[model samples]
Target: MSATLRSIAMGDGTAPVDMLAALFEARGWPCSADSAEEISGEIQGSWATYQVRCVWRAEDRVLQLLCLPDIRIAKEKRAPATELLALINEQMWLGHFDIWSDGGMLLYRHGAMLGDDGLLTLSQAQALVEAAIEECDRFYPAFQFVLWSDKSAREALDSALIDAAGEA
Candidate 1:
């Protein structure tokens, strides 16, 4: 199994964000902790380089993973993008995609609630990060279709959801 799948438990004594930093380190993804509560990393996806941030909320005992794809919607495209976000979120199982209202940046967000002991397993962390990336990668083309092409939100979603039968 990969390092990310190892059954390591965090939060025995160390902060959960530290555990995330270690996971990013193991993946060789450059990451840094701005404070004890948060760490950010860069992950390369099929469509773009994603900026991932893991934030630990000690008070709520929650860990949130935010993944931002390298796409920014123009002001005029915001309406269509918002429409697409709602459609995409409806199909999501774990995380949901949103556009940063002020900046028009596309991002995927998911949160995990830690146990009473504040322990988080490596697989949980891996799942959080991987799910965000996967969702962002999967929907990126839809955002592009809405923002850059002439496709409407529904059309873009339909186009993005198409599955390939075989490799070329």
Candidate 2:
């Protein structure tokens, strides 16, 4: 099946956090302080490097990823943020997931495993990594990859926030 891609630019006066919360709630995903705090930590940590943030969600066993770019920075730098977001957008377009954005609100994207085909399969994960690497090469160029996974719901929520940033 072909992937679905949707893009919405946040005009202004939108809070990424509030936008993300509403999106997740609208989709019936679980939202809690623990999850929010964890995602906040991840976003804070990533701010020094990439100017985007992202989040991941798994509801009723379906996985969804959200990305939010730092628009101000992206508009200023242009290439790095745009290229990185495009790569992720490509992943969504390939039937890899769902994507959208709200006014200055966090950009949002999601992926759910409707079947084995919809999941980010091993190959898809590899592709995601490669895409990220390519973007890093053009931007940071000296960045390194580190594998980390949180098997808790916190991980899912945090991922959603980071993904919303559209950094990786």
Q: What lDDT would each prediction earn against the true structure?
A: 0.83, 0.32
Clashes of each: 0, 31
Cα lDDT of model 1 by residue, 1-76, tens digit:
3354343443243457867777787888899998999999899988988999988998899988899887888898
State candidate 2's TM-score: 0.27
- Winning candidate number (lDDT): 1
| Candidate 2 per-residue lDDT over residues 1-168, each given as its tens digit | 111111112222122333444433433445542353113211221332222232334333343333333323223333333444454455443322122322322233334343533233333333433343234323221111101231222332334334333555
TM-score of each: 0.90, 0.27
Report the C-alpha displacement of residue 158, candidate 2, in angstroms. Answer: 34
**Positional deviation of residue 22's Cα in model 1 after best superposition, in angstroms:** 1.5
Candidate closest to the true structure, highest TM-score: 1
lDDT of residue 3 for candidate 2: 17
